[model samples]
Target: MRTSLSVHDLSFTWPDGSTVVTGLDLAIGPGRHGLVGLNGSGKSTLLKLVAGQLTPTTGTVTTAGTLAYLPQDPGSDPRRTIAEVLAIADTLAALSRMEAGDVRESDYDVIGDDWDIAERTAAELGRLGLGHLELDRTVATLSGGELVLLSLAALLLRRPAVLLLDEPTNNLDGEARARLIEAVAGWRGTLLVVSHDRALLNAMDDIAELRGGEVRWYGGGFDAYEAQVAAEQEAAERAVRAAETDVKAQKRDLVESQAKLASHARQGRARAARGDLPRILVGGRKRAAQVTAGRVTGVHQERLAGAASRLDEAEAAVRDDREIRVDLPDTAVPPRREVLLLEGVRPAFGDLELDLDVRGPERIGLTGRNGAGKTSLLRTITGELAPAGGRIEMKVPWRYLPQAMDLLVPELTVAENIARIAPDASETERRSRLARFLFRGRDADQPASTLSGGERLRATLASLLLAEPAPQLLLLDEPTNNLDLPSIRHLVEALRSYEGAFIVVSHDERFLDDLELTRRIQV
Candidate 1:
């Protein structure tokens, strides 16, 4: 196979002597490869190095063809239009056409004799779903999702040999994400993608994992990688358990040896102190015994130290395999006739009717295409925005979990947040409530700012339950946005058991299917 790119003995160390990449080697020829790893695992760093944006500290990276990168967040000039950005990708092609002396006097009257190139760019734009966007409109007017779509369209228009994408599906809705994946899959060039999207990874030819500054290539796609990871994790766990057993045995043996050596030394000393033996002979024997005991003691100590080090290494492996848990409080929500009423709840935007009829004990899912105003409807339901011609009446307790997860106070301790959100509770009661939510002891003392994404969600749910009256209505907007697979699974399990009325807005098909919402409203 021809090598499009090669890296040999690639090693890099930050200024702090920490190895981010060491003795790493990779070779890729014209095919799709998916890179998967945990957050902060140097996936982005490696991509930057591959893009020639950063030089390797101690190794060489040589590329045979031109490379282009699309970052997770595209930085587009606000003053440029979609067409202009697309044209940027065709600069070389346009220049080549300009140099060919193909300009006709009549053709100049239309697209200045470059009408062919412009037409090609226009077609590419339409293919990528930016056909409606004005070519001269400022990029600032585009939403975050729109920016990503336009950026990918521009890069593909360039027609480079290799394409690099970082979390391209993160901000995209389901339809857009599907379209982007299809575009990449149809392309006949080398592609390296760093994403957590399982579906996208499954579309690749191979999967590679970056862990502890090293890479392991799997023969198949995401499923193969997952199996390999599971096997490795199981092996590591067994090693940890075995090491702990050996360490415990070693500790007991060391203690026994030390005690025996002390006993021997004492006997030797007593024999030397006796006047019954020839003085020289007694002294020599005592010295001999002492030397032997000292040697044995030193050996035992060395063995103990080795065992301790092995135990530490095993413990580290256990820590790495540990999964983050998301456990929320289980509150009592009384069965109500009508928790909230959204009658004729016309939204502030969009062409949809302001009429939405909902009753208690219903799990409703709001689904729609991108820019369908799902979030706007959510805001209106939460009373953050007043509808132009609708009414929302709450007959029972209610709370809203916005997509931002801003319910918890970042500056305060989790315990403090619980207390602040429920001021009528006593200190003991607040602590007890937090404990029930799996934030017991020192965990409760952690600042909300220090929580992981899953932990923050749990904290918010705990606070709501701790209120004087448990909320009968629960509204969640994209609650699974930043969660990992396991966290999402845990949330689905919890919601399955929840008794309150639920209304969720999400574009995740898997999540919605698992939720088994009773009603689907497309905005």
Candidate 2:
């Protein structure tokens, strides 16, 4: 197979001298590849190195043909038009000038061979469910999910031989996600995508896992990769058990050897005390016995050390993926208690009208397309934005965890941030609660600015669930965005014990399924 992209001894380190990836080598052929790893495993950093967005500390990256990269944010000026963002504005303008009979040599040069660039761009946008979008439309007018799709459309229009996408399905709605998945499935070039979305990863031809600064390839998609890892983990656990047994046996042998040595020494002492032979003869026998005892003890000690080393290796082979565990009994509402009431509510953005009542510990999921007013309705409920019409009544204390995760104060530590929200919580209480969210000891003291995507989500969740007056009504918007697969599982585990009523805005169907949502509200 021809290698479309290759990395040789690639290494990268931050300005603070913290290493991300070291001595990493990878080769990608012409196929759709999925990159899976825990958060902070340097998946995005490696992609940036491959795309030449960041300089590698050492070694080189080689690409066989043109390359295009779509970063997690894919930031673009809000004022820029779709045409300009797509890199075809000049060609379109030149074509217009030629049509208007004001063509010049410079215009002809700008047009090049992409005379049908406009039609091609439109078709690409349509493929990604952006057919309604106009080239003259400003990016500011698009929703976050729409903007993401628009950026993808721009990339596909270029027809690059190598494409790198970081979390491409993050902000996309169900329809948009399906479209993107279809595009990925149909991609003919070498495509590498870093994503935690199981549906998206399942669309890949192969899976590449980055762990401990090394890349390991799996033969098939996400399910196949998971099966292989599961088998490996099972073997590792068995090895660990066997090693433990061996270590225990070695300890028993060493103890027996020591006991036997003590017995021999006592016998020698008794013989010498009885004057069974000349003093010289007795001394020589004692020395010989001592040497024999030393040799036997040495053999047992060597066996014990070897067993201990094997045990260590076996334990190290097993994965330690910790989970978040917490109890929120205080947040529970009575079966007949009305947690929230929305009466003919009309949000500020979309034209959808809603009348809903959340009672007791109901778990509700909000589903909609981009710009369909899901977030607007959430903001309206929080009173951050006044509803255009109708009334919102909250009978219990409520807290909102926005998609942006803006709850934390960057300069404050995780503990400090939690304290800011729950002032009545004692320091011990704060630390204990944060530990349940997997932030313990110095991790609780680290500044919020230093948190990875998963850590930040955990911190934000701890703040919300640990807040004073104990929120009985919770609102979460896109809670799983940018979180790794393990982080998402952790979030689900944390929520499993939550007894409060919640209405979550998310496009992740898998997450909603995990939550076992009682009702799905379409906005």
* Candidate with maximal TM-score: 2
**Candidate 1 residue pairs in clash (backbone atoms < 3 Å):** 344-354, 345-354, 346-354
Total backbone collisions for each predicted model? 3, 0
lDDT of 2 by residue, 107-130 (tens): 978987888888888788888988
Minimal lDDT window, size 10, model 1: 319-328
As a whole number from 0 to 100, the lDDT of residue 190 in candidate 1 is: 89
TM-score of 2: 0.94
lDDT for each candidate structure: 0.74, 0.90
lDDT of 1: 0.74
Residue 66, candidate 1: Cα error in Å is: 4.6
How would you encode candidate 1's per-residue C-alpha lDDT over 30-148 as one tens digit per residue? 89999876544577778878887767898988787788898765777888866676665244345545569765454334344444565666777677676788766888667556788
| lDDT top scorer | 2
